[model samples]
Target: MEPSSILVIYVTRIGDTMLVTPAVRALAQAWPKARIDFFGSRTSAAVFRHLPFVSRVGVLTKKRIRFKGWLQRKSYDLALVYGFDGDGPFVEYALRVSRQVIAFKQRKESLNQKLLASIDKTTIRCSNSVDYLFSLIAPLGIPKAGLHLSYVISESERQWAVARLAALRDGGAGPIVGLQIASFPTKGYRDWPVENFVELCRRIRSEHPKAHFLILGGKREWKRTRALHVSLSGCSTHYAGRLSLRQTAALMGQLDLYIGVDTGPTHIMGALHRPMVALYHPSSPSRALAPLEHPCCHVVDHPLADRGATEHTPMAGITVDAVWEKVRAALSGEFPPPLVTPWTP
Candidate 1:
């Protein structure tokens, strides 16, 4: 195959869309001249604006076919759909336009099979969602360059982030730490206790008085951020629900450290090479997505004995002390540091 010009369609959550960034980079590496485009939801699309590897980004809502005819006009050589469950209209839409389609489906959709150049097997064992997507591209012979997640910062956004941060610290000295405490409410179980974060802030302030904490999250999480602020009193500044996704990424990129649950922004921070500590639950597999090929990531997993009970919730069995150990290791210079040592309990 000539590595036909690719259009990678990832119309899922922000994190899922971000994870495709490396795949975009991979396509660019394989076919430098081939056009590479990323299609995403409107909110997620904002993050791709100035990416060098992407020629264009077509933002659309689920089942909104407004851009379908336009995409067909481009005559994409190949299309890959990330969130299709085999029956969605978008699955058929991608099939209708692209010369070749590669996708994953739960079971045989007669029409889907007819349109696709290839579909993932019905019974392939997988531990992570991104791995399932990667399987589709293996037939194309594209080497797995680990999981790719990126947030392209325009020059204007970069300037905004700089000015904002300068005002926060008044040109003071300290490690700027970005802390995100809430995930979507549906994944509320994934959040570490807010009290843990409060205590963490207190300890950080006592030890490293120069250090400053910047809380980040969406409007849905504002109450949680406020609670954390109340508990920590004078220790941190709350930037939660204030900045847009790209603005937050720019702010996080300039930070000395980042700590969060397995969420969209955390994935972006990972792509930018920021030192990160990710809290994981058994429901979400960090094995497939944990800052691969980057030595600066540390993962703490709360293992589950009964897989049936795990459902991407808050990590249980993990304590504040354990989290603190990982934070200390990350601050020091250990690449892929251990989340907890043998005697931490």
Candidate 2:
């Protein structure tokens, strides 16, 4: 069956939204002529911009779901909804706007019966999050296109990034490292200690001498990032609360290396194919969440990664020396050869 118009709805956090790109890419590859539209959270919606295959991106919220598609015709030939609970408003909205709808099995048996195909949420077929999300389209028989996350940085944004980096460097040639110090409040256990970062930066600068750092995060992390900036004094720039999500990503593209806790920007950096050392907490280990088929990714997993640690597990188990070794290897161009061929759109 040929689907001329498609709608994909996934309203979630920034990192989770990035995780869905592989599945979306597979859909585009299978239906090259289809016009695809995306619905995401206001912040996560920015990720869909600059993608060649996406025709439009709109914001979606549970609050705005009431009467949303009641006034319109069923405009989409196929629709897919992700991360919605059983018989939720998001599922109802998708049913109203599309000829065929696919989603995870809802709580109510009646709602599950309504979907074109309802995926069993507990099937446990995939080891990683990207592959798990891709399962939503398995009933459609679309071949997997790629497993790596997707992000497009435009030429203008690239230029802006370059210019910003130049200004920050001020003619001094040094390895520019970007750092994300904290995760969101709920995922605080995923964050490595800020003092560990300070010690790591000190070690990196001692070896490279000319190395510089870019402190990156949202306003919630401002106090800690500020302290690190103050400790680094002349060598680091604080960008924690200053830029929008896209702007932060643009600057991240210009970095020589990125060292971060597993978070949204780490996910963005994963898509850029740049040198990076990502620290993962045991609760959400690198095997499950790290970028797949990435050429330069260096993962530092916590000691308890295989021990079935809970969210209460501290990320400090991933030491400064462990992360520093990866950082050093990345800076020296000692990355292992690509294990798998990188997927292209």
Candidate 3:
């Protein structure tokens, strides 16, 4: 494979971008010599740093910014874009700049039609967003199974995380468990009750006397994390909203295990191949988002065991007992095989 110039665009939040890694890896493996460039939102750009196959990363700001004119000026050989109608401008950018453009073939909505008109190939019914983009490279004979996930952490980041943990623990424990208690509050039903977490931590400590728990989450989740810590009464250390995204990722890598809701940090842990117990509610697409490529990951689904008349919601039905069972299973080392190879690119 010659080093053809290629541009890949995926503009989504942290978790969505992380999901794209497997597809990225597939392209890189299939075209080892290609100069692969990635474009994503500023927040997601950090996730792509140090990725092996990425020669460069372009940060797309807001929405509808033109990287196409820039890439067109540079004359890249290939361009791939993810997202639906809202992403048409990106497809247009790819079409204008690269010799070949490949995009998802969604409903022939005007936006998709417009994007399709600009691109050379559009794939419909590629359900997995990442897989959809990777399939475009089939013309180059890249095998579908070649896709995998990759994320590189700096040695400094790892050291920084270890030191931070050491400082927090004050040499009390040798290994810590990472716990993230809350997902976004809007989807509050997705959250397992904080009391359940307190109970889980108590049991874990009883089973492994020397092990401590480290709570991680965003600022909005800080209060819940603190409450859980208080309930544990020194059995756990709260580090919620305190670390940068990458730092948190590095911290997660150092932990013996991770327990969290269907959230971004869990997805990051998934990328690192860290063992995890992910809690999911009917609100989340657990089958879609749970760690796909890592073998040591576990998922707990609780679809609101009871619902009153005239009330319906995805996560509101999940129960704590179901979550505990999944967590216990993960601790016992019974985990599912990754649904897909880690996405790399």
Best by TM-score: 2
Cα-based lDDT for every prediction: 0.72, 0.88, 0.70
Q: What lDDT tens digits, residue by residue, belong to model 3 across residues 90-118?
A: 66676667777667654545535544233
Which 10 residues in a row give candidate 2 its minimum summed lDDT?
336-345
Which residue segments of model 2 deviate by more than 4 Å?
337-345
**Candidate 1: what lDDT?**
0.72
Off by over 4 Å in 1: 70-74, 106-108, 126-129, 145-148, 171-173, 303-309, 312-316, 337-345
lDDT at position 163, candidate 1: 84
Taking all chains together, each candidate's TM-score versus the true structure is 0.88, 0.96, 0.82
For all predictions, the C-alpha RMSD in Å is 4.9, 2.2, 4.4
Angstrom error of the Cα, residue 188, model 2: value is 0.2
Q: lDDT tens digits, residues 252-335, model 2?
A: 999999999999999999899999989999988887889887889898899999798999988888888899889999999878
List the candidates ranked by lDDT, beginning with the highest: 2, 1, 3
Expressed as tens digits, the lDDT of each residue in 1-345 for candidate 1 is 664577777777777777666666766777889888777787657767788888888876655764466534647788777666445556566766677877766355675565554554675555445555566676577665445455677788778888878965685746788898887777788788898887776666666788878899999999898888777666578888888888888898788889898788877877787788888766665775565555588887765523554674446467888888888887776765422211100
- On TM-score, the stronger of 2 and 3 is 2
Which run of 10 residues does model 3 get worst, by summed lDDT?
303-312
